[model samples]
Target: MVVVNVYAPNIYTNRRRLWDKFLSLCNSIEGIWLIIGDFNEVRVPEDRWNSVFDNNNALHFNNFIGAAGLLEYPMLGRKYTFLSGDGKKLSKIDRALVCSDFMTKWPNTSLRALERNISDHSPLILSSGASNYGPTPFRFFNSWIEIPGMVEAVNRGLNKQGNENFKDLLLG
Candidate 1:
């Protein structure tokens, strides 16, 4: 797989130019492609919180993603990857986008947002391996409680007896 890590410019004009370049580059490549990094932009208004949404910017971003034929990989462990210093603004600016071929090769690939302790952005962990890795560490995110059936899911997980059984349940 071809993995491209990019840090896009904050300026809209510069970002547009860069996106064009990326499109050209993607066009020239063949095979699985994985694009990961801080895009400095959001595809939709829902991606940002406590901030003014820019419809124009969102349109540009969404167009780029569609043109690139990229799929936004589902993320776990956090609703947003970026947090302002004052903790007022939140957005998911960092993400992983994979082509369909890449998804076929690594069907179990996942992206996990690690704790953001020092930096403004959380570290993203990408795991593409198919090997069994025992039980996944149970992490309770307060935001998850808001989701319907999440509480029931947790209870069912906790109800499983024995370490092996619980591990198997989690892995399943």
Candidate 2:
């Protein structure tokens, strides 16, 4: 599993750069990917209320998501994630987006909004609601071999005693 936390800049140019960076990086990910963040942009006009709408920004944001093959589970408990200081404006700027690999691995994933306190932004919770099935078999990815000292780590694990420690070493 791979997790990415982002804080996209408010400016479109900077945000576009971030998107470009992520787009370039996305193809290399072979496992489940979850991206959660304050993106500072909306996917559509409906995502914002009482705020200036930017069609260009929204178009680019949607394009990025589509091009990257990212999926967003519908937000629950709230329609918006950000509120203006005066409480007049609302926008769904924060979200959790996953790759298809993630959805395939955890089909029950969900995104939920939590109550906002002092901050103008409300917190988001991403849940898979998966039940434990005891010990799962360990599966190694080819990418792990590229990491420094991974072979040494595996060798050390191979020498370790007991099934519990060995199982936990790889996937716990």
Q: In every candidate, how many clashes are there?
A: 0, 0
User: Model 1, 69-96: lDDT tens per residue?
Assistant: 9998889999899998899999989999
Colliding pairs, model 1: none
Output the worst ten-in-a-row residue range by lDDT, candidate 2. Answer: 163-172
- lDDT of model 2 at position 119: 82
- What are the root-mean-square deviations of the candidates from the true structure over C-alphas? 13.0, 13.9
Report the C-alpha displacement of residue 50, candidate 2, in angstroms. 0.4
lDDT of 2 at 118: 72
Model 1 lDDT vs. the true structure? 0.86
Query: What would the per-residue lDDT of candidate 2 be over residues 1-172, giving only the tens digit for each residue?
Result: 8789989998899999999888888877676778898999998889999998899988888898989999998999889999998899999999999989788888887889999987888889888888898666677899999999989888876766766654446422
Clash pairs, candidate 2, are none
